[model samples]
Target: MAKLYSKQKLAGQSMLPKKETIAFILNYSKALSIKKIGKMSFEIIAN
Candidate 1:
């Protein structure tokens, strides 16, 4: 997950807000992926 965030940052993609907890980011990412929400990537959702 850290690697993912780092890559996203490097790519200038949206990231999980710094004010948000890591736990929140992980769970939210999981939930979205599991539900296949919007067929979007985490980067898009983070934005």
Candidate 2:
């Protein structure tokens, strides 16, 4: 979970989604792609 207060403090009291949140989103997306690749590879081998 992203800490809203910490993000606000980091941005000098500015309002934003926070860099951590963006990084988490990016990382999650990459993980999803990796999972998809694994599944595809398994399907190919099974076929």
Candidate 3:
């Protein structure tokens, strides 16, 4: 179908997944939470 073709083209262009999309997948699918610990350092809390 045309939709499938467009999806494949977009995937080849590396423009389908944005930063937020990746972050959401990692943040929730991994069962982890992100919190502000310091200015630069990051802390991973299990949910």
Best by TM-score: 2
Residue 10 of model 3, lDDT score: 52
Better of 1 and 2 by lDDT: 2
lDDT of each: 0.57, 0.59, 0.68
Pairs that clash in candidate 1: none
lDDT of model 1, residue 36 = 38
Query: Over the stretch 6-43, how does candidate 3's per-residue lDDT look in tens digits?
Result: 55655466547788989988877587645676666565
Better of 2 and 3 by lDDT: 3
Cα deviation of 26, candidate 2, in Å = 0.4
- Runs of candidate 1 exceeding 4 Å displacement: 1-20, 34-47
**Poorest lDDT segment (10 consecutive residues) of candidate 1:** 33-42
Which has the better TM-score: candidate 2, or candidate 3? 2
Q: Where does model 2 exceed 4 Å of error? A: 1-14, 34-47
Q: After superposition, how far is residue 44 of candidate 2 from its true place, in Å?
A: 16
